[model samples]
Structure formats: C-alpha cells, structure tokens
Target: MNTIDLQVPHVIWWKDPALRNLYLAMPVLMLAATINGYDGSLLNGLQTMDSWQNYFGNPSGSRLGLFTAIMNLGGFSALPFAPYIADFFGRRIGTALGIMIMILGIILQVAPGVTSNMFIGGRFLVGFGSNISIGAAPLLIMELAYPQHRGKLTTLYNTLWYVGSIIAAWTVYGTIKYSGSVAWRVPVALQALMPFIQLIGVFFLPESPRWLCSKGRYTEAMAILVKYHANGNPDSDFVLAEFAEIQETLRLERESAKLGWAIFLKTPGNRRRLLLIVLTSFFSQCSGNGLVSYYLHDILSSVGITNTTDQSLFNGGLQIWSWLVSICFSVCLVDRLGRKTLFLIAGVGMLVTFSIWTGCSAAYSQTGNTGAGSAVLAMIFLFYGVAGFAWPGLTVGYSSEILPYGIRAKGLSLCLGITALSGVLNQYVNPIGLAHLAWKFYFVYIVILVIEVLCIWFLFVETKGPTLEEIGRLFDGHETQYVESEEDKA
Candidate 1:
C-alpha cells in the first residue's frame, strides 16, 4: 500500500516554527492515554500491596471485581453524552471539562480513611471523566494533524498508555517500601498529574478546523490550515486542495446526516463500518489481555512465582517492554506494515503465544515442573508484546479515521462505549474465573483468540493511503473533486 500522498507539498516539521510548536503541544492531548494506563496499572499494583489489602480489608471475589470494574461502568455511563460535548462544544472545552472531573475523583480516592464504597465512587468518577476527555482528545489530534503526517501522529497517540503504565508500575513499586496508607495513597493522588498537565495544555491547542467549518467558520478554519499545515502560505496548492476536500466531504456528510440515527446502518458500506467498529472495540479488550493487564499477581501465583517484590518487578519490566515495542510499531511500522497486516500479526501471534501459555500452565499443574512454570512467565511477556503491536496503538486511531466527519464523534463514542462495556465484563469475570478454575481458565481465552484471528482475517480492511476525508471513498464510494491550478501541477 502507498504511504500518505507524496505529491502533496511537504515541510520539514522541525524546521518550521509554527509546525514545530504545534507538534510540541500534542503531548498534552496524549495524556488522556497516560491517565488510562496509570489507572489500570495502579489497580493491578494495589492488589499486591499489604497496606492496600489491609486497608480495604482484603477484597476478593465480587468485592474485588467491583473495585476494578466500576471505573468502566462509570465510563459506560458517560458514553452517550460524550459525543454531544465533543461535537457541540468543541474538542478543547470538552477536554478541559473532563480533566476537572478527574481531579475531583483523585481527591476522593486519596482522602483520609476512605471507605471501600467511597473508593469505588472515586473510581467511577475517574472512569466517567476519563471517557469524556479520551473521546475528544484523539479527535483533536487526528483533525489537527497535517495531512502528510496524520496517520503517524494519531497512531502515536495511544502509545502513551504504556508511558503512563510504566510510571504507575514503578511508582507503586517504590511506595511499597513505605509502611502505611501513604504508600498506596501517593500513587492514587498522583493520578491527577497527567490531567493537570492536560488542563494547562488544552488552552493552547487550536480547535479542529473541520469542526470550525461545520459551524460555518470557513475563513477561520482555512486560516488555521494555512498557518500550521502550510506554514502561512496562502497560495500553497496543498493547503487549497486540502481545504477544498474538507469542504466537499463535509457537504456530502451533511446531506447524509439528514438520515438521523439510521446513518450508521442505512447503507452496505455503513453496515461494514459498524461491524469493524464493534469487532475492533471488542477484540481490543477481550483478546486475553485482561488476564495479564489487571491480574498479574494472580497469574504469577499460578506459575509458582509468589514473591511480592518479584511480581512488582515483572509488572514494571512488562510495562517498559510494551512501551518500547509500541513506539517502534507506531513510529516505524504502522503505515509500512498496513493496518490489516498488523492486526493479523497481533491476532495470530497472540493465539500462538497464549496457547503455549495455557499449555505451560497445565504442564506446571500436572508435573510440578519448574521449567513448565518458567515457560508460563515467558508466555506472559510474549502475549503482551504481541498485543502492544496493535491493541494499544491502532484500536482508537483506526476506529476514528474510518468514519466521515459528520459522525466521527459519534462513531468514536460507540467505540469507547463498547470498549468500556467489554472491559467491565472482563474485569468482573476474570477474577472469579481465575478463583474458581485456576489454570483451566486459560482454555476460555484460547478459544476466544481463535475466533479473533478468524474475524480479523476475513473482515479487517486496509486503510493505508487516503487522507482522513478521502477515506470515505473506501467505504461509501464518496467522490471528491479537487481542481488544481496549472502552477500546482508543475
């Protein structure tokens, strides 16, 4: 597949002052992923802390399930309304509002003598606020990025999840050396740090130009495109072509939006898009990742590695490995390997590694073989490495880019909502399944992974070359006309 259109005018981003500044400001938006990553790792790490376990009276079974799953429940509650906030108020304001709610959640979680019920409430608020901010942040990044670099920038967005994960893992590890509530509370309190940085950064970000055009502010939208995308060249052919494409695409989408809620399923192409969206959302969370992501302590126990410090170290090392692998894939391989290919690699790699992991578990159980137990540990790291290639990076970016501007926010909302729903189901079921069945629980995911690989092979589409607006052509055969001047042809 082709890369972003080479015919489009190119600027060396770092050499241009405005473009360089815009790129510098992007990490603020990416902190949404960081917050999410930290939450997952923090909860997983807390389960290992003696202080946390004693403070909460050693929650287990349904009680422990509720603690971890409530955040996703909170996120699910916000999904229906998150799109309205992003679409109507604009991405910047929506982001700021979400961050404020997250800060409130941090306060409740770290408050003195917080009860189990109160802690659950705090997590719910974090999930709710996080959904709102996350739904809007990626939209801003994708819409604001220059056309030539759009795919890479958006793919790079979710990779920050591991950055947050790495921080949380090490923070929890370091604090465990302390002897009181302060150990766990410090990590919970620090969850606010990413959102605080985001709150400051959101103000300086330019609003989406496509959103501006949707609101009938074409002149302002065009000015932004010229300044940041074309380095203030009013006469640049690339800018003019890009502006015309956005104008035409939005015009067509407006007419289609007249169908109201039916627009997502009214056509065959729309049906295909919906199918991919659901599959991508579901596969992202349910592909055996929940086993490792949230319950590493239990998984380690099964394999006979029961030391607390060793478990924490393994968690920290996994996060670092994941972050580095995700960066390599996001920056160097995403476009070159193509979306469909990466999904396949991740699906098949996971199925193979996880199958081996399950077998190792069984072998360790039957023979008390240390080698079989060690293989289980190796499989855990390998399973996550496969997941890093696609799950953390492509799930959000691909879902958002496939839909047209008219329903982009709604489509993303659907993606996130299903993601939260699946997460809730997994978090609730995983611990109980592990508690009751132990090593046998591995078979369930082994079966699920087989189905995942099949679905990806038959259903996933390649979307490597087109600009965001032009991607509609792949799904709906939407045609656009960009009349270039003779000078631009040269």
Candidate 2:
C-alpha cells in the first residue's frame, strides 16, 4: 500500500517578517480568550469571596451551585444560533455581536439592586454573546493562520482562557478583604471592556480570507492574504499558490452541490464526522473538568479546609499547575502523539482520578477522617490539572481538523452546539449531584470516561499530520478511491 506522507506544511518563519505580524495577532486573540475565560470563571471564584455571599445573602450547597451553573446555561442556550449567524454573516460580525451581548450581561451582573431574575437575564445575554466568539474564534483563527502554525496559534485561545481563570482566582483571592461589593462586581464588569477592545482591534485586522473567497470576493481575499503573507509584492508565488488553492476549493464546493443542514444529515460520511466530533465535544465537557474548575473551592472546603484564604490559595495553586501542564502537553505532545492517543490517555486518567476520589469520599464518610480525605482530594486536584488542559487542547485540535472545508463551519457549529448543551447539562446536573451526593459524583464521571475511551478506540481515525484534503478522504473512506484516481491521472 502506498502511503502519502502526512506532515504539516513548512512555512517561512523567524527571518520571515510575517512571523512578527502573526505574533502581534496572538496578544489580541489571547485578550479575547482571556475575557472569555474570565467571564466563565468569575462567578465561581466570587462565590468563595465573603462579599459575594453577603451580596447574594449567604447561599449554600445546591443554591450556590445553581448560581454558578446559570451562566453556563445561558451561554450554552445561545450557542446553537451562533453557527447560522457566523456562517451567514461572517466571523467578525458574529464576534462583534457577541461582545455586545456580553456588555449587557456585565451591566446586569454589576448593576446595584438588580433582582435575581434580572441577573439571570443578564447572564443569559452574556452567554448568548459568548457563543459568538467561542464559535467564531477557532474558525477565524484557523482560516486566517498559515497551516504550519495554526495548531500552536489556535492553542492561544485555550491558553488565554486559563489565564483569565487564573486572574479571576487571584483577583477574588486578593480582594476578599476590600470593602464594598466591588470585589465580585468589578471582575464581572471588567469582562465588558474586553469585547470593546477586541472590536476595535478586529477592525484593524483582516477578515477571514476563506470567508471572503467563499462569498466570491477574490480580490478582497487576495488583498487579505497579501497582508497576511507580508511578502512585499502582492504577486509572490506563495500568495498565488494560496489563491489557487482557495479557488480550487471553492470550485469543488460549488460543483458538489450546496452544503446545508439537510444535506449534512442526509450524507453518510458527513453524518459520521458530525457525530464523532459532537460526541468528542460532549464527552470532553462531561469529563468533569467544568465541574472541577467551577467548584474547586466547594470541593476543597468539603474535604475540610474551612478558611476562605486557604481554599483560595489551593484553587489558585491548582490553576497555575494545570495551566503549566497543559502548555507543556500542547507544545510537546499534541502534534506528536496525535489526537487518538491524547484522548485515550485523558480518558484513562479521568477514570483513575474519579475512582480515587470516590474511594476517598467513601472512606471519609465512613470514618470521618479528614486527613485521609484531604490527601485523596489533593490527588484528585492534581489529576484535574493534568487532564483539564490536555483534553480540551486535543479536542479543539481534533474538531478543527477533522472535517472537509465545505462542511467545516457547519459541522463545527453543530459539534459546538452539542458541546454547549453538554456545558448546560454539566453546569446544572453536577451541582445538584454534588449537593445531594457529594463525592459519589465521581461515579458519574467515571462512567462517562469509560464510554469516551471506547468511543475513541472504535470510532476515531488518526489525523495527526494529514492535509485537510487527506483528512476529509479518511472520513469518506475514499483514500483507496483517491489512490486509484491518482494512478489513472499519472
């Protein structure tokens, strides 16, 4: 069997002036993702702060969990619509609209004397706004970036997301002693500023050339690509090559028939790819990272750390470690190990962690031994840091690469919508389960992880270094067909 060597295309870098331009774009993308992360985490960190309890009237257990979950519920609820808006209107437009919604959420969250209903409404709007960026950012970045650096660059979103969480943890930790409700409200409101900054920044930046080309705006696409390439001359060979590729992709797409919601379901290969991507997303959310990140303080407190300062320190430390570990994994192993290996490793790690946590909880409940329980909880936290960062980076990389260009946006949107719904379920259900059953919640995670492991082994194909065309062929089981066609052409 002849095998096509699957490796990432090499791009001109370092001496290449465009590398600097790409680096400059990183901070802006990071800032956008940071706000996204901060908004997601602010509520959880705030719940541990004394001012938050006072403002909300000292809610405990399930009620606090419910409050935390509400934001995710709102965000998830709005995600399904994000794809349509993004596909139809373009990613820049989608991102701007999302920012606007977030600003409304910030107002509701920070406004004095706002009713709970008002707060929920604001959060829902914020969620709606977040859906736009979350759905669009990867697509925008993937389309804008050179293929060689796309994985590393796109990882910026997740990295910045964690940075935002870190900021939230430390911010709440530092401000807990300050007077006024600003401790919590300030962080929530700070999120509103990011979108405005990003909105302005985006104006200076180029739109996705792919989107422009899809709309038959070749001149605009070529101009954007020239800027992206920064190769002095607009007619450079690289620029011409890229334009030709875009034209060919567009021609094939137009010839193949319009890809829409109905055809997505009716097509076998597309349906399979959609199911795989969505399931991967769903399991990633359900793997318990969301619960752990949002409820670390509660979980630590349950293990017997009563002092708020101590809990904050523990959470902050955990976030730092997780971020570091994730960065290491993403840099060294993401491309090397391929998607399947990472998911397999992550699933096994989750299963082990959840089992240990369950055992610790059972032992603590039976003997009332806080010390043993604490040790076990510490192990669980360590497991969380490692798996939390790895799975998401892998999942995002996998989802972005697996589909054909024609259906990439719609397929990703559908997958992300399922992910969003999973986020809602995770936000709502995990808290309820934790409140009623506490450590037994590990059993639920364990079950989910086992299923994830099986699904990956049986269903997912290796996509380590294949081109988009080759990867698409794998999904369609057309590799043999393509090989024979190449022979005929030869």
| Best-matching candidate per lDDT | 1
Worst 10 residues of 2 by lDDT: 479-488
Give one digit per residue, the lDDT tens place, for model 2 in 306-400.
68787777767776776777788754676788767777777777778777777887787778898767876677676765585456665656776
lDDT of 1 at 275: 91
Candidate 1, 279-366: lDDT as tens digits: 9998988999887888888999988988888888999999999888888875568889888888888999999999999899999889
- The regions of model 1 sitting more than 4 angstroms off are 1-7, 478-490
| Least well predicted 10-residue stretch by lDDT in candidate 1 | 479-488
Clashing pairs in 2: 75-127
Models 1 onward score TM values of 0.94, 0.90
Error of 1 at 367 (Å): 2.3
- C-alpha lDDT of all candidate models, in order: 0.86, 0.70
